[model samples]
Target: MSSIKAIVDQKLILEKMEGKGGWTFARVPKTTANTGKSYGWKNLKGTVDGFKVECSLMPLNKEYWFMPVKAEIRKMVGKQAGDYIQVLLYAEIQELHTPEDFLLCLQDDPQAFEHYRKLPDDEKQKYIDWIFATVDEELQVQRMADAIDRLSRNEKLPKKVLSAGKPA
Candidate 1:
């Protein structure tokens, strides 16, 4: 994947969306986009404030793009809006493999699969990551089952919960 590194010496502006206010982002300059086209820009993997991240750049007018400076990142770097920052970004690979057991469970439960399929990519990644965090096969199976139950009911998984088998 294509990558870029640059210092962000601009202030982070707060923008409003859907009645909620949020921090604005530094933009991906056109020069960055040119390198990313061969790799696709829908999602990028990189670091901000030295923390690893995978995010999609928000497309702007005239082929320009931007990425939000999330609060978690702000806290990690110990800097707020208006602070100069550094960023390193590369196009994230498009191929994401879902576990076979999880896929089978989803196939057997159409309602759960429907809800799972409708989730935003990041949310889906959360569930997938949680389920795979451990190496225990039995635990992974149990987690997949629990995930199916939650999705079937259109319930969001609690952040603190790992699975029916164990605590995070």
Candidate 2:
């Protein structure tokens, strides 16, 4: 874990490389840049301008790391480009919190449970996060059952999990 202070003063400029769209980013404070590199995209929990955010730092180049200031963060912080945003970051080892319903469904199917156990940590995290993102009880149950069915049949999940209200 590392801590440092710096201001945010970059514009949300879009970049293009030979006509391909690029990311919108804010540079990591120079003092904290090295810390992000050392962590190599590990989970980070920190406060930016008093707003709590959890995300992985992206390497911008050899000299800096950056985090995308998405529309949600921008609105929450109420700061625009060039504002002096304060940040305090700490590296964290996040534990996967699979939803209980999802786990129960998997537990009932031995084949699914076996395949799920074989998934890499990061892949498993995606499934858990997908479940966590579901806000409705009924949809969560359906998705869990769908996931288990796919796993049991050795079928791949969709590239991304569909929202609760969306069909899979």
Candidate 3:
């Protein structure tokens, strides 16, 4: 089930924090986003200065919220840390769906399929989204292959892929 929350629009500076894994994001002031993270992490989909964005609004100390700006999005938008941007966003509870191709790959490897089935929804969603995100078909295939290998071994997903890209 999915539900859309209130919409928000605000100008935010893209800032970076040093200690906490060097996160780069824009703060969504509680004043602006009065409803995004009241329950927990809320998945958001909207636009940042006209560029499409789908992200999670993470709550901090229940005071404010921060939305991470991924490096890929930064490059596409040609914005760097400290740049001000107009953010138009709305939070939603998303329902995760397994991709057919990804499912086919897993079905071939019973152990991997079993592990994937037992994974938390977020973990499963990560793999599904990452595998489908790349426009390059070869990269997508490789991601699926790597995922199955890691899953069958009962290992944490490849850190590189988990973060942004496949490890070189």
Candidate 4:
């Protein structure tokens, strides 16, 4: 069972859900639990007991909501199920901008464009971010080309890389 009350102003919510193992890392405090409305999703940022995080506030079942905290975060925080930890968050919203060069490259291949469009906004943003996360223009160009090629092949990265536990 998960229990949390991540208090943000009205727009962001903090609630608990019924996930069997989600709550052990931290519980949203009960003091700010009863925020009036429920929304499908909200981007959240900040710390859960001073461990930095970027996560989502989302609904799980019919009656409640939860934050799906990552295992790495749980390990870093050194908390477990049934443990109580402080929750602090800020509602986050960001606009993703897909570079024109990427779009044009996609447009050159109908299948690639379709696959790219099918990707979630966050995934697309991550790809864009990764492509630009460098000072070497040559590497950035290579990554961009690789991204388009992989999309054309209907995959985020090559199968060999994934099978080898390597990230593209």
Return the clash pairs for model 3, or none.
none
**Top candidate, metric lDDT:** 3
Arranged by TM-score with the best first, the candidates are 3, 1, 2, 4
Residue range 1-168, candidate 1, lDDT tens digits: 322443222333433234357545666655555432423345666777578877676666555566777777777777665666667766533445677778888989999999999886667877898888889988888888888999999988886684542533
| lDDT (CA) per prediction | 0.67, 0.63, 0.81, 0.63
lDDT (10s digit) by residue, model 2, range 14-107: 2223344444456674555443234366356666677888766766676566776665776798875556566666654445566676788899
Q: Of models 2 and 3, which has the larger lDDT?
A: 3
Instruction: Itemize residue pairs with steric clashes in candidate 1.
Output: none
Tens-place lDDT digits, model 3, residues 58-168: 776556788898887888888988999888997665677898988999999999999999987777887887788888999999989988998999976666756766633
Task: Using TM-score, give the best candidate's number.
Answer: 3
Give the higher-lDDT candidate: 1 or 4: 1
After superposition, which runs of candidate 1 have C-alpha atoms over 4 Å from their true positions? 1-93, 162-168
lDDT of 1 at 42: 51
